[model samples]
Target: MKFAATVRAAALCTAVALLPATTAGYAQVEARVSPEFARLFATYQRIKTSYVDQVDDEALIRGAIDGMLASLDPHSSYLDGTALQRLNTMIDGNYQGLGISVQMEDGAVKVISPFRGSPAEQAGVAAGDYITHIDGRLIYGLEIDQAVEQMRGPAGSAIELTIFRPGRDNSFDVTVTRGVIELEPVTSELIDGNIGHIMVNEFSADVGSDVRNALRDLQGQATGRLTGLVLDLRRNPGGSLDEAVALSDLFLSDGQIVSQRGRNRQDTIVYESETVYRGDVAEGLPIIVLIDEGSASASEIVAGALQDHHRALVMGERSFGKGSVQTLLPLTRDSALKLTTARYYTPSGRSVQEGGIEPDIRVPQLSDPDAERRQRLAMRESDLRGHLVNEAGVQDEALERDRLDDPRFQLTAAQLEEQGVTDFQLDYAVRTLRRTAGTVASR
Candidate 1:
């Protein structure tokens, strides 16, 4: 769930070859295929002829292409058939399935997150849970796409998943009914003390407009006056880059929002405030952005912009650092290439490639019993096999450490429930905002 772009009409061809030869003035340059290509063809011929069993030409070629892209980076890959369809569905914001984001980790299907209000979440599927069986069939060695395919079926259909939670002693089974997942990109509520809590689930189309409308609705619902705001972005794997810029523009009046640079100079682009929207929509309300390890791509973009501009106080853990931009280049009618094209920088010129947008105040989700263990096993951009390195050379060890065992956060999940606090992060943020509601100063 990252940003994607359509292919441009024109491409710049500025590559030039230089050669040094016996003649000092000018040397002729020859253009030919590299010897590695010959080796690849040789391997393909060997696989076709000398293999014990007959091999399909298409499969071999596809494997070669996949291998080539895999060597470059994790994000660059071939998208065809179901993969292409899934990408389109996510951007369009609706599908029929048990909505959960998963990945292949060590040949096991690991759950990244269950979308809020989705069937999987309602069925008790949590992050860090591993799906070992589907419909009573073992699926340990299946590909992630294959597992996802099995989990998705017609709406109202029931699917049984065997989940192995890390902290639990034994695996458990849960039957989840697949339903039409109409993803609400933005959701809002007027909490106690007249604080507006806006949860941005994803950066899909019209997210900025939805958030703007949500703010209006919350303002209308407040009894006295709108005290403060909480922009909840936790577990929001990102989408549309344009939407991220638009969302940031709602709070920033001037200055650069984000900038991206690629190999070609033409690909270098800068997004500034007032280009998407006019001015600050909050009207100087104290705001807090909640992020976690699941907040990625577009989420980081908005967080970085707001934090850099001093427009909001960012709380929660460091984000899932993914600063590169992926552009979807169509190869055929039903196929495309999701290739990493550029690295984006924050308004302060900080590249959150490996080191994500660090919160101004680190806050842990004390309501979840397994939050401590999950944080230790969480994966970030730096954990990927072939991730792009930040040119600024950030060291993860230098970043602020987690406060999982903080003395101030001694209340257990059971204790928090007894106190009627479901989400400690949002509760803490709301209280913090109430202390400085009308006195908040913005740059």
Candidate 2:
């Protein structure tokens, strides 16, 4: 079966959300009617009865629900109809469209990242690009789901996107042909000196098993025994939390992978290794994890776990800092609430809220001409309006570290291109692995 089908099958058998359903009955809790609630009801009544323009009850109700969640955090939202379907589409890991993870930023559709090897990426859709129009239609005030639905269509269909890139002088148009985006969560190749390079594009269904199989396949393709490994999570907007734990368990024999703490006691839970996978699949291999500003949620979980355990040397820029656990609370068969329930922490008890996973080795991608400019303009969790403050009292200055210039990474995109270096960070990682392998062999 396809991975998407596998996810649906798993969803049917287990709780739809990452956490189990609460057993406590509502009758057991004390009920209190506050004055604020009375005010809300009064306002609702006024809106229903005396509004200048007639607004449907459904729209008004949904708006009230959305407003309540909007005040809490950026991740929490009321999912129904197209929104719920989009969420399911992400979990399914395949869709016929220009592959991109997008979010509404101030009523504009902002590209989080173009999926690696997808038509959007090939067509030059970039992270932080504002999608202003789809096929000449203004998407300024449209819901994110509505805009995304307009973008997605049958395979082989062409769509024109008007993009407003931050660094560019003027808005541009890009026509891209939609294709079947089969999300291969894990892809690996045997690099020079028998170093296995695995790029995890997303955390989808059976990703842990897929990664394990990829490692085995890479090992088989190697001329000699694999000396090292590079796990790339760059530009990966995370998915299923179950798969995150499972993937981390594949590399860690024992110890806490991640912990979630919430207002409720039931939400406080810890996940450990050696539960999903028996032992480290790549035992004794020097591993490096690559992360960047786009790597979030589940990606942060895996990176933070391995880094805290000293199992892998994390490299690249700081992560997207989305540490909150979003629970899918189904209100009905056709609707659900994507609510932010808990905050996740690394093994060392580091909260990944505003403060993301800091890499052990900081490596910058110098190959992209707009890398520096984009880094400065990139929107992170902390930058989002109404974002939850870090419990550990992280300062705004810490999150603004990306704005500082690094002396080590002075190479321009033109210089790198002249030297035939497409991906500077990956190239540096590969070379580092080779050097480590040589040193190990000498011993």
Considering every candidate listed, which one attains the maximal lDDT? 1
Query: Estimated TM-score per prediction?
Result: 0.90, 0.90
- Model 2 has how many clashing residue pairs? 0
The regions of model 1 sitting more than 4 angstroms off are: 1-32, 166-171, 441-443
Worst 10 residues of 1 by lDDT: 12-21
> Candidates' lDDT values, in order?
0.83, 0.83
Residue ranges of candidate 2 with Cα displaced over 4 Å? 1-32, 438-443
RMSD of each: 5.7, 5.8
Report the alpha-carbon TM-score of model 1 versus the true structure: 0.90
Clashes of each: 0, 0
